[model samples]
Target chain A: MLTRRLSLFATLALSLLLVSGAQAADIVRLATTTSTYNSGLLDYLLPKFEEDHPYQIQVIPVGTGKALRLGRDGDVDLVLTHAPAAEKAFVDADYGVEPHGVMYNDFVIVGPSGDPAAIDGGEDATNAFATLADEGATFISRGDDSGTDKKEKHLWEEADVTPDFKGFRAAGQGMGEVLKMASELQGYTLTDRGTWLAMKDKLDLEIMVEGDTALFNPYQVILVNPQRYDGLNTQGAQALAEWLISDEGQDLIDAFRLKGKALFHASAGEKIDPTSAVHESD
Target chain B: MHELMNTAREALHLLLSFDPALWEIIGVSFRVSLTAILVALPPALLIALLLARVAFPGRWFAISLVNTFMAVPTVVVGLVLFMLLSRSGPLGELRLLFTQRAMIIGQILLAMPVLTAMLHSTLQSIDQRAWETARQLGAGWWQSLWVLIREARFGVIAAVLAAFGRIIAEVGSAVMIGGNIEHFTRTITTAIALETLKGEFAQGLALGLVLLLLALVLNVLLGVMRGRGHQTVSI
Candidate 1:
């Protein structure tokens, strides 16, 4: 009788787990950047992650600012994004627990086949922006606070003269949509080369200019500060951060490529020395 | 001041231009929101109609369930659906996770409760004699239900407006389920969120303006409909 009663209690506990499991997800919400998402890197890497990790990874790819904000608000378990300036500020502000290097890619200036701004010469990013602004080329700015947009604005500031061109346009959309619109309108845009390469098959645009010292784009993965927010899922965020920095995760990043060209260079364990190039020195 | 004014003017021109990207983002938002609302409306109205007119074993419990769902947060709904659609979980074979369909499923769930509860209240608050009059006028059971629906038209519209408002503005479900992918699954709210994160507030601001326009249009449409509804009711 004692044994029977114990078995019944065990069965009841198991049933409770089953019922709750049906209604609740054991997934971790990963807020990240559109570049990381639109490139199709997460879809390739996350299955391996979920296979090894206990929780399913539910990715919410937005802008780095929003991804970090989601972390700041403890709305998501982890963040994968670029834009070192914003990430530094986010880390300094104590919004995210710890930001770790995920990968690096360069931003490219893409434009129509006709090269309307004449920004086609292989000049650096700052010069290209100056030329585009000078020509008032129909520039499609993301207008969204995405890492790419920030970098574009930074380039504009670096080039002293802001262009007074008539054809400036704000897409206020993601990298892919902006690129597609640029293609349709035969305009110019700044995009992370990774997304551009992945979406190249769908566009009539070409890389107008690249090889800018100011074009280096670095990505990082960070956990939300669990201590600050009561709703923070500490274990899940920690798991995501730890996983992205692991050898397997870095390998996946290295393996991620589009059209036989590597999209992002892995930088997880390397020290990012920031002293190489400053386009605008005060 | 001159340069600043020039920059401001450029920004304004950027916003006002009939940029295809602007229309594209709004188009994406409308497609996603309309799909979510249309997918949700039938079930929501059915549940509301049942809750208002029918007496079931769990009548109060059903009402309470819908009320509970009205307050249920979007992320929570995304989380719940994520579980059901994940590979290791049951119904995993469908592989519905991270698709626009999955996002719609999430939004449908999010919008349904608010729609149902609002509709139920509307139907319940209607004059009881209206249903009786339809019934006595040789209308069959389905005809009476249709007349009841027509009589509660304004209330239904209000519920629809509320559902659309709630679903379109929601970022959590769109991000979690739609995965906020560009070119395919991205919506205005999700795009705005991503843009804001990247500090391209201009892009976000543009999307924000569109979203605001959408909200204003919804409000105006509701106002016009409500006004017409009231005028017809008096007649």
Candidate 2:
């Protein structure tokens, strides 16, 4: 009798787990970056998007590379990321389509208040990086193959410097954790403005350099190609992509702020040249 | 069905290559769990002894608290430790965040409640006359404690094994506190999480297979040891 009851309870528990697991897949899966998720932009915008739509969106925050890979694997219905080259590669690979401009933010070189590298307010990000490298000031790199990490590598390449010194620490972590490491170590790091503004209060670092055209960061949303995967919620993903670029979405992006400062400048509904590096001055 | 066969093929290829990355993750998982269980053992055993043998005010409440703590989520522990270790936190001066030490500390907290609760029950169910007889035979307090522990050695071993199991299999706190930094704090479970999220099913399944094999080997080792030298406790 006891064994019979034990088997029945075990069966009930297993079936309950199965039922819940099945219910979880009813929503649209969107893979996005940590910047959008951590900066509270998604929290502000997703509810508004879901209000008029039939689908509830599930957001998976990961690095740009992983987001694209998830899109390629058809594990997620769509992706929103900021790495242009990688995003283009994903599109070229036939994994995603309809890449729409969502918003724009810029990267800033943040460092200690004392400014040991003395590159504060520099117009050229590469020049500032060269100075930091020459001075051997401690620098933290995300090193996680994130979009931010890719941007930092581009700046290093432009600066003609190898950031391989002992002072350079490649922390395979998120932007917020990297900022904390930089703060504690009094090091310099490159971060998107959205994450910086959201987490600035907790950090002692300041923006040492900004306004370089290369520092411009634009976000894009893309729907996964349904032809490559079976049973994908392609219609749901397209609806989300469409809603994000709508006038309501653009206005919501413009209005979302962190501490009275707008985190992302809205650029939706604009005819953005896909190849153009930066649109800030234009 | 085809994916399963492909994953099996990939797992075999990874295993046959004697891959350094796979072995490194397995090593990290074992090292972290071992360090955490070792660090927690003395304190957990002491707490168990105190709760089991001593009759004090609110002892039942303390026992209930331990029972409750055993069910606490790993993510909650990770979040509390993450805050404490963040640069803006009060203890941030130590700069211990995102390090292997932080991962070990998180795992210690994750495993401690399991160890203490299991060992507490183990000590409680032991024959109380064993302690009394040890004392009557001129055994001192420390000697009597040791005698009781020895009498309940099998249960104590089981508790240690259970704690090891809990910490080794945990992913939430390890990812949050450890940051899943590759070549630094990434364990088998965290690597599996990263790979699975990145859509690298083969690598994730390979690490998962390693974790399962490790658990199987450990349980078998425990069974053999139990049958050889120590009398088994059914519980």
Q: Which ten residues in a row have the lowest lDDT in candidate 1 chain A?
A: A273-282
lDDT by residue (tens digit), candidate 2, A1-282: 999999999999999999787666558999999988998999999888878877789999998878888888789999999888778778888999998888888899999999987978577888899888888888888877778887888788778899876578776678998887788768899999888988888889999988888888888899899899998888888888888888888889889987788878888866555465442211
Across B1-235, the per-residue lDDT of candidate 2 in tens digits comes to 7877998899878877978878887888888899999999999999999999899999999999998988999999999998898877787888887778998999889888999998898888887788889999999999999988888787788788878988999988897878676666778888787656445678788888887887897787667655643443442
How many Å off is the CA of B97 in candidate 2?
Answer: 2.8
Q: What is each candidate's DockQ, to 2 decimals?
A: 0.16, 0.20
Output the worst ten-in-a-row residue range by lDDT, candidate 2 chain B: B226-235
> Which candidate has the highest TM-score of all?
2
* Candidate 1 error regions (>4 Å): A1-10, A13-15, A18-26, A273-282, B1-235
Model 1: per-residue lDDT, tens digit, A130-196? 8888887777777666788777767777777553357665545678767765665467888988788
Note each model's CA RMSD in angstroms: 14.1, 8.6
Score every model by TM-score: 0.56, 0.76
